[model samples]
Each structure stands twice: as structure tokens, then as C-alpha cells.
Target: MNDSADVSTSPDAPPVTIFGPDFPFAYDDWISHPSGIGAIGPEAYGQEVAIIGAGMAGMVAAYELMKIGLRPVVYEPNRIGGRLRSEPFVPGEPEVAELGGMRFPISSSSFYHYVNKFGLRTRPFPNPLTEAAGSTVVDMNGESLYARTLEDLPEIYAEIAAAWDNALERIAGFSQMQDAIARRDAPEIKRRWNQLVHDWDDRSFYDFLSTSDEFGKLSFRHRELFGQVGFGTGGWDSDFSNSMLEILRVVLTNCDTDQHLIVGGAEQVPRRLWSDTPYRITHWPVGTSLSSLHNGSPRAGVKAIRRADADHLEVVDSYGVAKQYKAVIVTCQAWLLTTEIDCEESLLSMDLWMALDRTRYMQSSKTFVMTDRPFWRDVDPATGREVMSMTLTDRLTRGTYLFDNGPDRPGVICLSYTWMTDSLKMLPHPVERRVELALRALDNIYPEVDIKSHIVGRPITVSWEADPSFLGAFKGSLPGHYRYNTRMYGHFIQDDLPAHQRGLFLAGDDVAFMPAWVEGAVQSGLNSVWGVMHHFGGQTPVDNPGPGDVYADIGPIDVGD
Candidate 1:
């Protein structure tokens, strides 16, 4: 689940890679192994493990460890759900604006496994011109164009699509690589992927597009259109300077398309895990939950972490309460390690610290407002079409998402989803001002529609960059940082770490192959589970080979090379 990049090539030139030259390990395959992951002996059962952050990664790791008879105490200063936040704009309503982790791609099987496990209902997310999205209006250069299908757009759009396809197929064997990925052909995937990593790791996503012969053939207007009306996920000009590997991972893994959003709220996944008793384990009651394991609510934010003894670490909560645990798993954003929490200088190795400090997070802002009803669904008698549709524009609003709760129920709209500089522009504005700015942008797009008349209750907007807890929306690595990423991604392997860092573990989207996807968080959690199990002399069932057990054969190619 990494980002993607572009590569330059002609139809007759050598096939290029898109995601990266790095091996995109099939975490789904590893987790699905028949033998099941390794387990600790009864002697080590019921031990205490501290988990920071109650997000997907922390919750998943805690749940799995609980299944093995370990006691996991989660600490969260704010609400339980971390980035998967769903805000209820109005009281006693089913409508909610997903403040974080909205859309999930079907390719993220690792994340889906838990969703399916919990029987959470999901619906196709409305993205761009997709049927599920209803209708799309792309406004650019003061001109508004409506499209129910790709064909409805100007011929320039089709040409751009063709160029993109040619660039992907000719340079990266896009279809073939996806096929290899679907088949879980590790050897073939590695061989094809490694070459891309080596060649494109240092290249920018924009570089890939500009250097391509297909793109070169097109007028600059086509390229601008392509950027404004991106495929699958939508406009990515904000990520133009990002490593091509980041873009490649999104496209190659199918993480950008065929997406679904959890019904009710994505936060329910972790919130339910806290109280749901799915299975029984030794040393705990048959119906034990994470909340019960901690006696009640989670601890406040961690203030500091330092070694207390040779075999234990002390965690001090915000109230200055110190507790010793055999191990600690940090699932918070990497920046929090250095900025929010005070850690002993020697707590982590210099290499690991550098990796954590250097992690670059992309700024993201989302503004959501609830309407009394599905006002956008109303058809204009004069135009014979819905007044407003899912919108994509180069304006200040950027990308907008629409959510219809029901025919009569209230609906929510993500007025804007701006990234990088676009997101930064709203940093100084209050929620009300931000909402006004978005309404102004929409007013221009749909001059005939009175969007403000339907506003109900209050609006919720967030700038992740302004939030200290998260620091930023998610990691968006730059070129030539593959080695640093690899270091963080594989930090769970305690054998490779120095003795002092052995008991500490890292698990989050940032430490995952797919930085922005929940699937990466899930996989990273599972990785830590395997790591902690091994640290305590636990063993997976002989049939279920852990990731580390198979690392020598299928691990990602060393970034240094």
C-alpha cells in the first residue's frame, strides 16, 4: 500500500514500474496462512502490554494480543478513534461527516478482513464520475462541465485517459503487474517491482508524467485537465513532487478505485472492538473487552517513556502517573514521538530516530456540513438534472464529496478536501469562515442552486496540520526516502534492533507500506503482534508462517540497493 509514481517511456521502450521497485509484500496472504501466526507459551500469557493511540493500528494489535491471553491497556488523550473520526453534526441523527478515513479501497483486504469479521455494512463511496457517486461536475478555468460518464467529458479528457493508460502500460506493464499482484506471485511481483524502485525511487510523480512520450505528445491543456480531473481518487497535483513510488503503490494496488465507506461511521470498527467480546482467551473472562481489561477508560496521553529497569519500561501519563510494563507499542504518529511525548534520548537508536524525525506528513483540510435533506438530489426543471453533484475543481474547494443518508433523512456533504498548500490556506480561518469560503466556491459552481438555504445545525471542519495530536493528515514521502521508509516499516523485527529498543515497537500507517491507507495500519499492527510474540518467546502455529519467518524469502528489496 505505497504511493504511485509516473515513469517515462514510449510504447516500444522498456516497461517501467509505477508504485516502486520495492516488493509490495502480500500481507493478506501472510495473515491468511492456515497455520495462523505464532503464539506465546502459557508462561508468558496474561502479561501487560501498553498500547498508545486507540486508532486502527492500536486497536487491531490490542485485539489480536487479547485473543492470545495478553492484557493490553490503550492510552488516548482524546476520543477512542484516532484518524477514523466521524462527527455527528446534529444531535439524534444518523447523518455524520467523516472527519477522517472516509473511503476504503477493496484492494485493502487486510482492512476488510476486520470489517467483514465484525459484519460492518458498507456502501460504494461516491467518487468523481463513478455511478456510485451519482453525477460529477468538473469546473475548471471558469467553465463548468457535467458528466454522467467518462464519455460526457470533452474529447480532451479521453485523450488524457489514453495517454495515462499508455504511460502506465508501456512504462510499467500496469495490467500485468496488477495480475501478478492479484495472483500473489511474490517472485514475479518482486522482480518487476524492484526494478521500478531502483529507477524511480528518486523521481517525482510529476517528473514521471512530464518525461513520458505519451504525455509529451499531448497539449499542456490536456495535462492540466488530467491533473484537475484525476482518475479513481481525483486531482493529485498536490502530490506532484511526491516520490513516484507513493503514487505507484496507490494505483498498482488498486487502492485508488473500487472503494467503499463503512455504514454509520468508520470509527465504530475500533469503538466496537473496545467493548465487543468476540472470543475467549485464558486468564480473562469469556466476555472480556479492552475497556474491561483496562478497568474502564484508557489512560490520558503519555507524557514520557523511559527505561525503568533492564527488563521493563516506565510510561508516565499526563497526570504524572507512572506505570511499568514489560513492553510498549507506540501507534501514534511518528512526529508525536519527538514533539508531544518526552522520550529518553537513548530510548531509540539514532537510525530509528532519524527515520521518525524525517517523516514528512501532508497537510489536509476537510469541511463538512449537514443538510436537512438530500437537497443536492433535487432536479432542476429547467436543466433536467440535479442541481449540484459531486464536485471536482481547481478552485479553493478542490474535491467535494456528497453523502445521502436516505430519501427523507438528512445528508452530509464534504464541502472541501484540500491538500498541501490548498489545505494550508484555511489554517487561519475558523470553522464558520471555512464553511463560508466553501459555500462561496460552491455558489460559483452552481449559481442557480441556493445551497445555504438547506444548512442545518452547525458545520464541522478540521485542519489536521493544526491538530497537535495527529500533527498532519498522513505521511507523504518525498523522493529518495525509500530507505528511511523501509527502516520504519520493518522496525518490528526486534532481532535487528539494539537491546534498548527491543521492547519498544512501532505500528501505524506511517510505519506501513501503504502510508495513508487503513490496510497499512492493519498490516503494521499484525506485524507488531508477530514481533511482540517473538520477543516473549511465543511461536506461531507451524502451519501459519509469520511475516518474519518468510521475510528472508519475500521481504521488500533493501532500499539501500
Candidate 2:
């Protein structure tokens, strides 16, 4: 069935782009994400909502806010699209980069929408079929081997006729169920669905599969295949955070919608949004350090000790660019709101903070080797001779984490999906040493591809986990992380707190959909806008944020005092 899933394709296209376990996420999938379900926003107009990040979530919020007639000003300290990057190295050499997380599941609905919104082409990327087969883990004795080639694999997987159909159908069914649940308004039905989500959220898919011995072993084996097709691993193995479940649902639905890749790369997407908007999106030296809040209260707006050296919400740049907002909607991570922001200790509970700290955040590095000549062909990297993703009758597996790209750009460019986030903590090297280690790993994957030797220029190393700007790759919400308990946005915005319009809004992965990939960020932006719009109780316009707007969206964020 895996073979059958691998649809026949035109010779001129990226081999894996057509279909199968190796296809990348499409950009048109519309997920019924919480934010996608019902937009949050203004009871009035001329309200200011600041979207901190420029990724999909933030962009979605911006769009929603505009629709609601709220003036949203986006504040990005770096290029938009958060982790998306593409740059010219040796003048002629153009490389797309993902300093943070990258990769789109072909079935993710929300991802599909963004791809279309940006008009970025999503061509199939090279798979092991077109290139040479790469490597993944295996037992020393090779007993637990997971091979891309069926010639050397077990019979169970080869029973592709049944297992393949069952798994795909099951996965699809799960998607439908989730969609149904998302669309319904019944409290009891939602309660049951949430129960299932919560039950699964407490342990690994491995644990659930353990109910059946065949399932246990098959799942373990299936995990290996995931690597081959580039799904990769997550912390869901132990206990899945609430956000993790949402992420899974979203990625699984992309094939059914339309998400676009912005032409010229993702960074261009946000840049366009920022430029097209009437407000300014200037970069300040905002990293992961803490900043002090001062003279803050319900009656008067909050003032802060803005500093350039401070990596957290500096609200000021070393270049003396300290500005104020009537309303600020942070579009970073929810964790940023929890740890990086400086506010009263009473804003959030200590139990909440402690509970958050227990969840371990994995790290990974994202570096791209874009050269003038595609030197990957001459040298073969596999243990034996094999053709990667290009040929029809060839070995198939993962590419550079990126699913597809324009045909003009032939070589692979691994972005955020490289998944070095959790691994960064183990990288015992500076930029130079890290680059060497990465090259070694890349060479291992594509032996035919040589970077150190044919490498044109410097390989860009971005530490999403280490970057002071972004402490982690994404936001998280572990099991039972209920928004009501935290007086979350749904309720917080309704509170008669004087801080509502102190220009403090949170537009991170936590705002809405709390933990569901880029969808949360987009939703958070909308949530913050809603918070601000509702704060004024119809006093302001509910449309695009203008310079005159002043509202912040950080009601529930928990930064250390």
C-alpha cells in the first residue's frame, strides 16, 4: 500500500510531491482550529492590537483583526514568519532557511491556507527515490531494523495491502472525528471528545498501542518509517501536552485544504504584511532576558524599564527606539508570556509556573547548505548504491525536511523541520563546532552530497532553543491544561481589570488553540484582538489596527516578578 500510495508522477516534477508517505504538507488545508472556528474581536473600532510574531499564527490574527475592524500594529524584532529564512550567500547562491521550525504536513489544513495566501509555490522536494537513500536508527544486531526497501524488511509492513489501508483509514477517521467535534456546539459531546483527547494526552501513542502486542510492535516499527518519510518525533512519547494533540490534528488535516508558501520564502510573507500595514514593525534588541514593568495599574498605563541588553520584552532597542503601544499582542510563544515577561507575581499562579517548568523542551539546529552547483550527485552517501527521490523506480525517504520548493532551486534546503530543537542542549560546540557536526550529520544522510568540500559559503546556524529572541521552538500545554483554571483569555478578557488596555496582549502559541502549531499563534493574535476589542466594550473600531491604537494583549501571561 505504501508503494501504491506513492502515486506515479511526471518526469519533470519532484518525485515525492505527487503522493505517499513522503509527500510534504499542502498549503490549502483549512483546519477547524479554535481560532479558525470563531474569530475573536472588537465590539467597536480604532482599537490597537499588537501582534508580536510574524509567523502563520500572527498573520492569521492580523487578517482576522482586520476583518473585525481592529487596528493591529505588529512588532517584530527580526524578520517576520518567526523562524522562516532565506538568504543569498555567494551573491548568486540563493538558499531558503528555517532558523526555527519548518516543514508542512501535506494533510494539514491551516498550513494549506497560508501557502495559498502567500502564493508561494509548493513543489515536491527530493526524496530518497530521486536522490540516494539516507540513514536513520537501527539496532546493533539489526534485528529491529526499519528499512525503506521492502526487499530487506519484515513481512508485516509488506502486508501493505491490509496494514497500510487500515492505518491510513484510521488516521483519516481520526481527522473527521476531530473536525466534527470542532464544529459542534454541544457541551456534552465536546466533554466526551475532550475526555478522549485528555486520556490520550497523558501517555505516548506507544502506550495506547500497547493494548495490543501487534500494535505495540507495529507502532515502534512504524515510528522508524516516520523518519523515512520525515514526520520525526516529539515529546508525545512520555506524556503529550494539550498543545501537542492540537498540533497532531492540524498536521493530519493539511492534505484537505489550501495553505500557500509565500514566493521568495516565508520571511517575505510577514514582511509584506508589515509593509502593507499602516503601522510600523521595527526590530528592537528583544531577546529572552527579563525586563521590568513600572508605574503599571488599572487607571494609568503601564510603564517599563526598557533596556537594550535585556533579551526579554525590552520594549526598547539599543538604538534608543523605545516606543509605546495602546495595546500590545505578543505573538511569540505562550511560554514567553510565562517566563520572559516582567510583571506582578500575582498575575499567574505559582502552581501554574511550576507545572509548566516540568515539561522538557527539546532542541534542534537548522542549517542549510545551498551551493552554486548541486554537488550531491557525484558522491553517494548510503551503505550501498541507490538513487534518491528523483527516479521513478528508486529508493524513497526523507529530504531536507522541506516538502517542496520551486524547481529552479534544485538542491535540498532543510528548514525548521530539521528538528534540532531538542538536540541543541546536547550540541557541545560553538557556532563553528556546531556547523562541523551538522555537516557531518548531513553527509551521513546524503553521502552523495558533500558540504564541507563543495560548500560555497558559511552554513547559517540558528539555535531556536538557544536564541535569546526565541527560547523554544513552540508553545506547549501539558495534560489537563485548562484555560478556565488559568482565567485564560476566554475569561480574562471579560474581567473588569484596569490592565485590559494598558497595551498588553499576548499573541503567542497560547492565545488560542494554545498548543496547536502555527495555528495557535494566528489564533492568539485574534484572541488578543478580541481581548482588546472587548476591553473597550465597543468604544473602538473593530477593524485593522491603526497608529492611534493602544492596547496590549498579555492578561494571562506569567512572567517572573
Candidate 3:
């Protein structure tokens, strides 16, 4: 009973270089595939599968499992959606602030599938000075410049953008890599991407920028300004110390472009999945949902996971309630396995433990204030310019976004989305103090605009590093962490894992090729679904290839090489 499904490639198949540089993975292929990812026999059907965390990954896994005729009991201590949290400033109003993941790229097809299927509306996220964002103000060292378009910036800014483009072309074969990625040509992608991994895995992003001949020719001031007015979002100075591979993935996959924000809130995706009845299988009725399976409430947070027997695993909740399941999937942050939960040392191998323990998470803090109206849109009487613009600065308040809910309704303004040291600076402060500091910073950038007067409701703030469940904002792989990442990312395929270790699976953005994106979480969940199905003596349809199947044919980037 070989669970592995072999996929054959035609000898005459053309080289895969057509898909454009967005992430080449085709999740849409499987989601719409008939017969789904192989079904389990009647005996394995309806069996309880324990899923930890009710976040996007866990919920996505649970939803798919239910459709495949398995009961997935999810345990979550905090609210649903995990890092996709969107907190409301005023209760029962559409005016809300994204405390976690705010924007999503159009390239994340897997995530958009659920978004589109669930009937969720989305609007273009105003990243810096994008058209939808209206205008942008870049403030640096007591100086401010407003730009409605990239051309509006000084000529030097154009030079910086070109230097970055040339640097990528020179170092990473930008065009070929993008073409390979677009066409889903695994061989070309692996060849080009692996060369980057091998060369840049040990290099810091800052090092790559500084050493590039294109950037090296520019004055240091130009480099500083480049960091101040970064592409896509805002300043990326915080990511300077991270592995260059991380930045390349974001840029290459288009994760930083054509982004959109969920209209109502991102929380709606997981919240809807909790109770939405899309498909029924086996014991569950036509309208059976995840909530119905759990008796309308998620189980308490998992406290520990232990090997109850060779065939099953024991999971202990925060309340000391222990439950046994034939299979378990751990979708919580990787660090939670050691920091928050007291799991048996034997649950994961020493190597796996090293990967999980060594995982680095970048700290992030955000403060959002609700304004009476979209006051930032107001024009100055004397200056004849916008009083204030969606701001990017080197000050304490790093990036600011304005969410206009129209003229009359209240609007939300994300005063800051600070990372690393900046995030740490505000960790000890309270929300009001944080808001005050942000206001003071804004005041320096917009002395003419009285922003405080427009603020209506109490400001909301979050330091993701302070959250017990999530030890940090998201996985921030450092230089030389490629091997560790490969191990964790490939954990879904457990064919080589010992029988005792085969039941417990891992899935999340942290265990994905692209962390800090909802699509990564969704793709990881789908990978876990295939693995879980394979473990239960299931097989994938011939027309539909699972991740493992694809990986077998075209292996992951051998970064260790």
C-alpha cells in the first residue's frame, strides 16, 4: 500500500518558463480538481483529527479535512484568524485596524481562492504613494517631501530605483528567474533560485545592497534615502539584517505589489470558514461545519503533546484536559512548541527541534487611531496641498496608512507599523502613550495639520512579540538558516519519518516558502491535507498533483549545496 502518488512528465513537455515571475505554484489546479485529494476508506472516515490553533492554517486544514470526510477538532486559546487579526476601533462598525496582516498581494492565488469563494470584498491597499493610497509623504531628518507618483520624487529617487533593478539583474538573473517562476518551470526556478540561495543564503540584505556595484557607485546618502523610501510598502531598513533570500522571495513572487486589503476585515475569511458549510462528507450532514463538529466552540489551547501510543498521540489543553487522536496537526507558531507549550522532547526529532528552536521572529508593533473623518485628505488653505499624506518616515512612527470609510463615517489610520528595535522601544509603553508618541512624530512631519483634533475613538495598539500564543510577529529567517527552513518546510511529507513520528504534522506560514503571507499559510495547509490523506491510506487523483508529488519530480531548492 504505497501512499506515494507518482506523477509522470511527458518527454516532449516544453520548458516551464511561461508563468511569469509570480510564485509558480498552481494551487488553483488542485482546489478545482474533481475527486479532491484522494479519499480515505470508511474506517478512517469521520475519525477525529486534532488541529491546534484556529488561525488561517488550522482553519483551512480543518475545512478541507471536513470536506474529505474527516472530523478536525481545532483548539485555539485566542480569537480566530491568528496573525490575520483585524480589531475594530468602534464595535459593530466597518472602521477597523489590521493588528496583524494588513495587505495581501494579488499573486497569492491560494489565499484569494478562499477570499473569492467566501464572497469577501477587497480594496487596493495604499502602499506608500500608490494611486489608491492618494498621496505619500516621506519624512527624513526634519525634511519632508510629498509625492503623488514616483516621478514626483526627486530625480535621485529614480536613480535609486534603477540601481536596485540593475543590482537584481546583475546578481540574480532577474528576468530569467521571473520568467521561470511565471511558467512554473521547476527546474529553471530551482537552478536560478538555488544559485541565489547558495550565494546569498549567508549574506545580509544590507550587505547585498551595499556591495552591489550599482548601489556602490551612489553616495551613502543615496543609500540612506533608498532605505527611507523603500519600494512596495514603506521603509525596509528593518529587514536590512535579514537574509537576502527573504527579500528576494518577496520581490520575485510579487508579494509586495498590486496588494489589496480585505474590505470588511481579514478576520472574515477564517470566521466564515468556522461555520460555513461548503461540502459534506461521510458522517457530517450536508450543512455540517467546523463549529458543529466542535459543538460550537474551539477546544482550549494545547498545553502539551505526548506520544500516547505508537498509533496515536495525546494532546493536553491549557485546562489540563488531555485528548487522544490518531493524527494531530500543529499549526501554531513554530516557537510555541518550546515557549508556550510543554511538549515532550521526543515528539519531534532533535534535528526538528533545532529547526524550531533556531527559528527567528522579527518583532512588530502597530498603533492605530480612529479619526472622525478622512482628515488627511483635507487641503491646506495657504499651501494648496494635502494637509497630511499617507506617511513613511525614519522617525519612531515608521509607516502610516489611512483607511477612509467615506466622508461621513469614521476612518482608521494606522499611525505606525514599526519593526525590530523600533518595535521594542514601544513594547513597555501603554496604548495611549504609544499613540501620543506616534502623534508627536506625525506632528514633526505635519506641523500645519492638527491630527490629534481629528482623532475620535481610543487608539488601538499591538506588540505581536508580547502575545504569549505568538511569540513574535512572523518568521524572519536570518542568513544561513536555509537548511533549517528546508527541514521545516518539507515536514509535511512524512514518508521518511519514523512510524511513531508520522502522525503529528506541521503547517503554517512559518513552514512555507514565503512566510508572513496568508497564501503561504493556505498552501501549507493544503500540503498538510495531502500528507494527512496519504498517511490514512489515501491517494491523490492522477490529474491533480500534490506538493509532495511535485517536489518529488522537481525538488526544493537545494540551498545546503
On lDDT, the candidate that comes out on top is 1
How many clashes show up per model? 29, 110, 4
Instruction: Return the TM-score for each candidate structure.
Output: 0.95, 0.63, 0.95
Model 2 error, position 453 (Å): 3.8
RMSD, each candidate, Å?
4.2, 10.3, 5.8
Computed on alpha carbons, the lDDT of every model, listed in order, comes to 0.84, 0.40, 0.83
lDDT of 3: 0.83
Stretches of candidate 3 exceeding 4 Å from the true structure = 1-24, 280-283, 559-561
Residue 129 error, candidate 1, Å:
0.8
lDDT of 3 by residue, 329-356 (tens): 9999999998888888887789889998
RMSD of 1: 4.2
Model 1 regions more than 4 Å off? 1-26, 29-35
Candidate 1 lDDT over 436-534, as tens digits, reads 999999899999888899988899999998998998999998998888888887888878666877788899999986888898888889888888888
Candidate 1 local Cα displacement, residue 432, angstroms:
0.8
TM-score of model 2 (CA atoms): 0.63
lDDT of 3 at 346: 81
